[model samples]
Target: MEALSEVKLGPCRDSPYLRPLRIHYTQNGTRKHWDFMQTHDSVSILIFNTTRQSFVLVKQFRPAVYMCECARRGIMPTVDTASKDCSPQSLVAGELLPASAGVTYELCAGIVDKSDLSLQEIAKEEVLEECGYNVSVGNLQKITSYRPRWLQQEGTEAYRRGTNRHTPTVCAGEPSAADYWAAGGECRGHRRS
Candidate 1:
């Protein structure tokens, strides 16, 4: 006979955006439990330009990752979020690395929620917001549905979901006019009117 295991999950704290939870399961007939964070499904866009032969990405400061790094180096602790209120996110206020170290380079991405817009439409919007690319949803080619690493790291929700990514495109508009694509350097363009 094969052994089986049952898993139980419940929220530990109430947050408007995210729900951190406690998960209990059976492993080799032994009961085990883990704490994690849960969030809505999301989409990521890969903005690459063929004319410039470059990829567009974003840089943002992530508190959780930085706090964890600090904790690892004995600089500080991860702020036992599982125990205290995780709602404010002010818990990670411990000594953290410089802002430069916390900044991460990432692709254009956003959470999926607006019911009116289609998945492709959402991807188009994210590309525009994060990468400043004005392109139509039709122009976006479906690449694959990928769960972001940070999302997975926060918690392992049993909910099966997919995040659509657009395939590579030469240029949504005039190739020469696009601002983001650089031959082999950083993109200085931000918040274009």
Candidate 2:
């Protein structure tokens, strides 16, 4: 968990989601570079809608996910033939998403800022704020605390774009940003292979 470098690109003009102020500066020897710039903070949740046996997932148009092949690799589930009615490709290709395939679903997650709040507390708050759910701190599972896909704004779409034939129906909260669309909408451009 070492920060290699950070670069701030500067403020955005008409971003309805974020306020522009600071840019990231990356460590490059004695000089920090601007190419590694990034957002100040972000958060996401892996909410399980217990009643539906479905995970609460978010969707948005991600330029970065489109830029990288992450959209393809991230949602690709490994095969387990012992189980019936599911395979990685089938899970990916199915009209409906399984609990596992929904893992890559992205939402508007923010970085913890206030000094008074602990990360766990912040995580609980974010889940409530983003999804309108009241979850206990004990119920929250602390997954890996790292930004493996800091750049993947919409990588979830990759496994999803051409396969919305049976995607789950999501009960979404008010979207934090334009990228945040409901989990499944009437298919617009999902093309099957």
Off by over 4 Å in 2: 1-35, 59-105, 147-193
What lDDT tens digits, residue by residue, belong to model 1 across residues 99-149? 555567776667777879877788777666666666667767666665445
Q: Candidate 2, after superposition: displacement of residue 19 in Å? A: 11
Give lDDT tens digits, candidate 2, residues 1-193: 1111121122234454334233356566554422222233444556655555555654433334332332355533354544555422432333222223323346524465655865556666665554555556665555545443423445565222322112111122222323223332213211101
Per-candidate TM-scores read 0.57, 0.38
In candidate 1, position 136 carries an lDDT of: 68
| TM-score, structure 2 vs. true | 0.38
Model 1 scores a TM of 0.57
Worst 10 residues of 2 by lDDT: 1-10
Alpha-carbon error at 113 in model 1, in Å?
A: 2.1
